[model samples]
Target: MKFFNRLLIDFAYYLQNSVAYQQKRRFFYNLLENDEYKYKKYFDICMIILIFSSVSILIYEVKKDVHDYLNIFNSYVISFIFLIEYLLRLWVASSVSKVIINQDEYSDLLGREFDLWFVTKKILKEKFEYILSPKAIIDLLAIMPFFHELRLLRIFILFRVFKLFRYAKSFQTFSSVLATKKFEFVTLGMFASIVIFVSSVLIYVMEANDPNSPIKTLYEAFYWSIVTISTVGYGDVVAVSKEGQFVAVVVILAGIAVLAFTTSLFVSAFTEKLDDIKESKTIQDISKNKRVYLICGYENIAKEVAKKLLLAKFHVVVIDDSLQRVEDAKKDGLTALNYNPGSIESYAKLNIDMSVQVKAILCLREDDVANVYTALTVRSINTDVFIMSLLMNSKNRNKLIYSGVNEILYDKEFVGLVAREYVGQPVAFEAIHTLRSETSAIHMEEIAITERILAKYPTVEKLENIKYRIVLLGVHKKSSSKFFFNPSDDTELETGDFLLVIGNYMFIREFNKHLSHKGEV
Candidate 1:
């Protein structure tokens, strides 16, 4: 018994750690996380297999006594297994929440880290209540309670079997889309209502006159009602009289009109809904595994910021109210979540707190008050986060400084200075390209000459290797805020002269090693 238990533990551990299990886990979690493509594909394949298997079994059962004791026993076993799995799933989900809540509590109680036994106990002790909720109830119904008597209740089995399809990604996506597109479905419902009204009236006027008509009574009007609206004119229920024939013409024309209207409505609604899903998916995808970059407002500057950030390979997401600006951001390859950045719920929707490694947030709202609010909201979530903001008014600088913004760029002051420089110096304007260009060979480096170089080369003449591939632009003296533009060879290199050397990656690597006795250490 001991060996058997040990073998089961090893098998479970192996199953948990296996590549296929991990992939399956990722596929389902991605579905929950709103990854459209991966989730959809995974679910679609599973759905096809499920539908095929269930339907195949149902067909086979049609030829035999499906209510046999062995078959009933097998179904009971399957249901029990499914119930246990569902309970385990709920337990795991609750444990994830507890890991956050109990970590601090356990650390204080144990005065040490969490152990495997405690975790196992927590898992084992998870009450049946969690899995017995509404969804779980539905799952229980789906797996248990045979729907009908001796005929095997194949259709009931079919319905119950569909519950397994929920575990697939495609089904989840379809559910999400149905939820988000509920309004579209509502509009479709209105059209359906109109079609029903018109069809019932036409069917009553036409079929009431026919002697052999199945749609004789008001309640029976529904039979012809469906046939007329769907344009499926069954010859068995013929309207032979002149007045009845007139009603038939109207019904057929109304059916054509309804068809056209429904087709158009579906196309338009689907297009709008598809755009929303795609934009939402894009933001979710980019923000999946990396740091967060927040854009406070939707303006021209915000758009420009997005362009620059996208170029720099940053996962930039925007929040703004202007419908046009949000639409423009979508047009310009930036994921824009529709929300006010100043709100707490807005941050939660964006999952800003969940991003463990956010580099910075740029608050560039047009209004000073709004920008300040945005900054405050960001700081509230993460105190240690780096924030840079655009101060539209210089008057708000003092207040912003007090709000924990590391740097604030006043648009008027910053842009005015740039304009002045552009008018005064053409060379300074040209140098901006070198600073921004990724492929430029003429790159600046801050080389710190240490004891290693001093010991190796006694004089500046021996520094020929450093001067060969690179231009010695200047030396930035560490102690002073001064630039020595052209230091001659006779100027002896000190321990702290951060040389503004312009060179390629190769020369920079070589120079870095020559100076640090640490030699790349």
Candidate 2:
């Protein structure tokens, strides 16, 4: 027995820490998200609807005098599907991937390879644990039609309603709140049960022998007690005797107190729950965004850049260490996360690595070390992601460059450059001012020759027509790492090439609108 137990423990270790286990976990979690896998989400939604409909049918069957064969057939069909789902879930536990990496168990089990006995043990462990899981139990009860003797199992069909909580965030929050306050609720329940019982007995004793009493039996007295305590006293039941009337008054007063206390508890819990739901909604919104401008620091420069980005109709996600700055950003109508800006863990929490939607990350920290460190971390996660850093001192610009920052803006030098431009040409300064404002009709925009643009306009000359009064400036090719300035008409456009064009704001909007609608607009 000891030898077998040791082997089982080793098997459980591999099963729990395998690559397939983590992959399956991610797959299921992503399926609940709207933007990740649409088909999987649809499958989950269909199953939830079917489960609820099945329960409703079972309820209908309970009340119907005439038995419907169609209902039985439908139940069988749903059960079969559920059975398949259950089996699939169980099968996924013994994942196909044999190797595990970067896990805590990897160090201890370094030299071991998967063999026949290990595989068998892992499979057994998976099946054993899954059969004991809460979802599996619910699934089993849902398909209890196969066993006619377990008619009571139909009561567990109500668990189907709770399965919706897995998909709906609001429902999940509500359920979590209830679970968190279960102890308090249970205490209140016990007190209320005692109140009802005591009141019922007193009313029964006081009014059982009265000539004008509507309450006679224990059940009738209990019903009267509950109705009176609930403050919904019907005139059909009343206490005729003075003693019974006094008891009724006391019960009414107790009901008022109970109602007030219960309402307060729910209100208090809901207030906290609202904040949680808000954060969850923000994460969901982030997940749905196709691209966002990620601002690392919440400094003045960061704020200005974020405002411009927002005005340009680009989604912006701000990460700040200071809670006050995060709140300020939130007040300004930007989605802000409060955490360590330099930590990759913070980015992970925001699902940065999981999303290809981070268009650019702007490091606006005054501290050079922080900026360099953060830029390196961002590049490590996304090699192709564009990174721009704001430099308080020109000397630290190389630090940012060495850390793989794509662009470095010397804030001090910018002040002198602005003065130079303003001294020579007022119109040039105004043009720049208008461009920075993000609302001017004439602005500079960079449109990449993505696959979509490649399909629409294959060459540089093909896109030089300027239908909306736009100017073709230059193309920044990713492969060459150089900008071709006004090349010949034959200069071809390729994927990853950024077309720098100074055009009317409306013209840029037209490109986005046409591309999005495939020229429908």
Candidate 3:
């Protein structure tokens, strides 16, 4: 018992510490539950196909006999797959080993004996909670048709259709909308029930004595009431008496009012959720890319930057709290989200930490406070992601830096400096401005010296020889974090160094392609 206990503890510790194990677990978790996972859509598609096929087979069997092979495949094969899905879901729902390890660590900290029974109970409690969850219950029921020996349990084969709710995000969204209006729905339900009950009672009382009336019993009257309220008058049941006809008219009017109310409620719920659904789709689309520029504000500067990034073939996602700004970004043909940049929940919703695709975060909110908060929130979620923010006020520069802003732009100060420079060198300033602006075909671009580039061109002279049209203005060294202006030909190029080059946009593109293909330009 002692040996077995020790082995179990060691196993739990291994599970908690093992990188490979944790990675595998995380992959499974993402595959099963993470909507932003790259392969989740494919997984969902496959599951949907299986569900439809299984349900189709079940429905087919209802009217006619199925082949023994088809029956076996549906009953055993699909059920087996569902059984595995259920177990995997259960496994990912909560970590039993994590709970065990936490308990063991707590026991050690308190200098007490490890309580196996306590850990067992806690694990059981978590598993039980998961098992009782609506999705999990559906999963369990979906697998019940495997036990075909029990003829009564065969009806559960239909529950496989409900499994679509798990894979279809739209269904979940609809369910969420309905969940939010629970109180209103409950009130509507109560009112509807009262109307139905009263209508049924009145119809039964008025029609029971009338020999010509089709509703002879309370059950029949209840059925008639449902049919009438639903506006599906089968014409099989008729109220011959005037009193019965009056009740029917009243019930029909109430049904129309109830339906109108229900329609209004659904319309309002969906209207409210429309933005959220769009945002979710935008996030999913952003997640599909392996690299994306995250712009926190959809202001003028941010919009221009996003456009430039998009033109450069880089994915860009604009996020702002202002709905108008988000809408403007959408209008401008950009992926945008209406989300609070300062809120940690927004970062989590974007899956920033989980996604290595976020190449950089640009906080360009006009408000200094909002920029600082956004910087802080992003830094907390992702430490290594490059962050740049616009410094509206000079005084907040230190605060922005402390909040983990890698670069800070001062619009006023920059403009002032440019104005001063323009006074001294009007022609030079204008030429530079023209080159930077959209009107000019010439553009400035940075080319990073990757391992391939470093191997091919070890010196500045070698790189310059590769392309004559492109001018190597300066080299930004990653090591010293400084730019070497007009470096000598003998200057050594290294990995992580960026070549600041100026050329026509087409020339730059050709130069990059030359570097990539390792061929003569």
Candidate 4:
């Protein structure tokens, strides 16, 4: 028994540390639980088709005998699919090995013996809670028809129709909206139950002995009460006696009031969820893009950057806490979201981890503290995505840097330096400004040195022979993170270096084209 226990513990530890196991588990979890998964729509459509087909088969069998082939297909194929789905859901719902490893680690930290019974109870409790959930129960019932030997459980096959709730997003949203009004619904349900019970008993007592009445049994009266309260008075079940007629009139009035209340309740709940639903849809739409630049503010600097990026054909998404700012951004033709940049939940909602499309995050919020917090929150969730923030105060420079900001733009200092330079060298400043602005035809662009480029032009001297009106400004060496300006003619170029050149837009385009096609022939 001790050896068996040790073997179990060793396997649990291995699983906890295994990268392959973790990746496979995460893949299954995303496929099963994540609505934002890329292939989830295809999976959902397949499940919906299977569910509808199985339910249709069940309905058809009611009127006529299904062919033997059809019956076998429905009983075996559909049931097997549902059974596998149930087991996958159960497997991903909780990790027993995770619990065991965590408990063992905690026991070691405390210098105490591992409590096997305690860990066993915790694992069982987690699994039991999942098994008893509403969706899990439906899944279980939907697969019961596979046991054809147990004919009594075959009728539960109808539960397959309920499986649509798992695959349809609209159904999930509606259910969520209703769930938020649980208190109102519960109170309304209690009041309706009381009215229904009283009416059922009164009508049964008033017409139980009348030869002309339809409510001869208590069950019939109960059914009639339910139908009347729902405002569906099927004239087939009528109350002939005077007392029973009076009870019917009162119940119908109560039914109208109950329905009105229910309608208003649903309308209010849905009204409150409209914005949230729109935001969710927006997130889904944004996730489809191949790449996007995230702007964490909608202020002046952020607005200017967004405009430039948009003009440059880069996808830009702006996020702000102000609804007015978000609206303003949308009006300016930029995608915007009203979300708190400092909150971790906002990043999760944006699906930052699942999307590799976010090229860079810019924290341009005006407040230094908010910028630092946003940077920290972003860094906590994503370490690889480049982040740039505006440093509003010199004191917060270190704070932003420590928060994992890649670049800091001190607007005031830059503007001050430019003003001083303009005062001393007006002509030079004007020329530089014109070249950087859109009004000038001259452009500065960086060309990355690939293996092909190195093979064709091994030295900076070779670039001089190109048939283009461009100037070699400098070369950026990636290995040393240094830029060599005006290097000698024989300066050797290496792979992964960037050539900084300035020329007319068309000249630069032709220069790149020439280099690309040079080695082709």
Candidate 5:
């Protein structure tokens, strides 16, 4: 049965590809599908503006003498756009479903195919499924204005305005927060219900027998109880007797307590959920980032490195396999995500494209295979970006080097070095001084030399005539096996060389800026 099932699936996929779709499937897919395609934002913004205008028109038409000859024409225009959007969305669904079923888009290597009925049935099935989806239902509702003329029906059509919430990330976060804390919401609701029932029964028994009582029946007493508890005691219902008034006071106090507790719960949930939304958006916004650090582990060493980078006021994103560690990183005010670091989807989930400004990636996993795999993946995605891998075993060093890792830090060597430095262990506190300060006289910076800077400062010897108060420590080049440590004054400075310099931080900044802006350094 499994074999036959696979056969049928393959046949259907092949058949779907044979059909001639009328519109540009890829074009409509990017424009209307759920994924954030290139043009999707602009398309969504335009649709939202159109929806708001339509809703405003509906509200205006509700007033007396507001209807004009253009009103009917305006309704037609809005309905037409909604209809186009709905149809386009359906087409997008069909295209996506077809593409999903057929990953390779196999050509006629073999001259066999399924019948037309098979393909039609599969395509129509997908369309039917999409029509029942929540977004599709919203799209359809946006077009109901043309189907009816009744004022009451207009209210339902007016709800089309709510479709705007699909684009509102904060509102979506609030809904998700509510879902996550549904137990708390239910508990609060049950508690309020119990209070309402007890208060209603008490007030009814106390005031129902009185002929002049405003709360004359059980139903009226229930209404009065609710109003009193909510602090909205409408004059239509009230407690006339002193005994009834005492019960009213108790209900008001309970209501205040319940409402305050509920408000606090909601506020806490909102804050947490809002932070989650902001973190996700921050990842998305990094596509425009000119330089960012992508740290690929959440271990102690990775954490320390990330802290140093962040202290230098650099943007850093950490990816790890453990969800708990990712959350911990986020709680520590660090940007982190959970992903299978070896997967292509993980790279895509970095929320960056090839053009993104990626300064470097840190592969600090203890697993040599995982580190090498990540190095290869990052290298495939970006050829120029630096990849620094931590060697778990000496034997894997050559493997990582072959994987295009720009640098390797051997763990054993570092551990040995740390062991030797045990005498000055308290010197760890000196790192705090590295944090930039406005009053600090000296700061270290790695300034990259470009072709323009190389034209003037052709060699280290030429830099001595400069009046800028700075000291050159060393130059690191990707093409070299080791850094050129305090090279001779005549050593040539290449275009891609990185300069290690110490000076007044502001002066260093201005000097690098000048190098970047001109033909001469």
Candidate 6:
């Protein structure tokens, strides 16, 4: 029954390879199929089967006679399968357009001008270069015509299975980790190469002349060198003479030291890279359709500020000199633009748009001087733009305010305020901060009563007593900073009348109904 099922599947795949089926395939055909999970399931199953089969073959190779027979069978069978698979892949390459339209595929490969034979020839010729890459070459070599002579080359077939490891979760993540730490890895690789080469040469010199020695050529020395350094000590090869023994001690000690050092290098590299990846992930999340909130430094307060900005739907763009903090920001899905925020060029390069409806710049650089400088540069660009700067020292607060920062957040004042509130305060410290935060998404906007609408409506405050949730907090008479707190219901609302309402965002939105109705009136 399983055999029948496998045969049916193969037949379906063959039938699906037809040109008629190809033309009707849409771009994103794979996506449209709605069987992504099914495809992945089948792919996973194939991977498991392939891995087990390879492992079984490797185990069988330990027995000489069975190894020879199995190797011969695999050499021919795999090569033939690869040949057919290669041909089939070329045939169905056109179907990728059903996945997504590539113009080159339409005009160049499978154009109306090309016949079946021509298309096949063209694809093979075009992909011939890619087919010659190290991996592909090994794959093709595993399946070549001289099957029996290349029994050992069946081992190269294992490379194709190794390719499957790339698709695995662990290997994929490892690859990304390597990519992130490519430079460090490259340096470590160079160090390892030097150690390996030096060890191999020394081992060959020390062991080559010994009668009982297995290390004959430089190649044999390389194998021994790898075993020693990795502490694998396979025991298949060893040195025997007194001088060789002395050399062995030195080599083994060197190997141990080198092994520890290399391990440390990789550990450090991966640690740094992982942190970077985390920070980048955090920045990406923060930047998604959100307003920018530039954090000047990686202070503890900056962390709290970032949380607040995130709550208000703002993408926090941080500029900090500390690479570690930048990585931390990335981990939090915040844009840690790694630079000293003190420089004018840094702000300019970051594209500080004064005119755009941005929330505000929160300056909290580690250095008081840097924060003040950053604030000054920002204020110079756009005097109308809001700047919320934290002054580390109370002395800088007056300077920052005079320098044209809209709001100066004094840590001392904040701490004192919190203490005062703990004793007994009118409002919560957090609530006061929320209302004072110019960058908050929830803002109290004052809309003036225009005359055209007032001609029809005698009073705007009359609607306040309707028992709805929207409260009339205050009324500001025209051109006066003085606002009437909790204005009367019958107060005649004239032109240029400013009404202050207090509620959460939904009520504020609902509060706009009065303006819209007035416009219609």
lDDT of each: 0.66, 0.75, 0.88, 0.88, 0.76, 0.64
Model 6, residue 365: distance off in Å is 2.7
Model 3 residue pairs with clashes: none
Estimated TM-score per prediction? 0.53, 0.76, 0.75, 0.72, 0.59, 0.39
Residues 78-113, model 5: lDDT tens digits? 778878878877866766445435432332334444
Tens digit of lDDT per residue, candidate 3, span 15-53? 989999899889989999998687988999988998888
Which tens-of-lDDT digit does each residue in 224-283 have in candidate 4?
999999999888888999999999999999999999999999999999998888888788
Tell me the spans in candidate 6 whose CA falls farther than 4 Å from its real position. Answer: 1-291, 380-383, 421-458, 476-478, 490-498, 503-521
Instruction: Decide which is better by TM-score, 1 or 5.
Output: 5
lDDT of 3: 0.88
Q: After aligning candidate 1 to the native by TM-score, how far in Å is the CA of 241 from where it should be?
A: 7.2
Better structure of 1 and 6 per lDDT: 1
Candidate 6 residues 1-521, lDDT tens each?
Answer: 44653454455455457666654343223322222233644554564565456547766766745656565545555456556545543443344322222332454475543233444455556566556645456445545533546456545655656555433545656666766666766876787788788878887888898778888989998988788777888999887767667767777887787778767766876797776665555443443423566778877888878977777676677888788987888677676767776676766655445546356878876567878888887777777767888888876678888777888888788788779886685567667668657665455667567765466556755554234466576889876667888876576777888877655556666656655464544
lDDT score for residue 421 of model 3: 94
Model 4, residue 486: displacement in angstroms? Answer: 15
Task: Give the best candidate by TM-score.
Answer: 2
Off by over 4 Å in 1: 1-81, 85-151, 164-228, 233-289, 354-357, 392-395, 410-435, 438-521
Model 6 has a clash total of: 12
Q: How well does candidate 6 score on lDDT at residue 186?
A: 80
lDDT of 2 at 381: 74
Deviation from native of the Cα of residue 492 in model 2, angstroms = 4.5
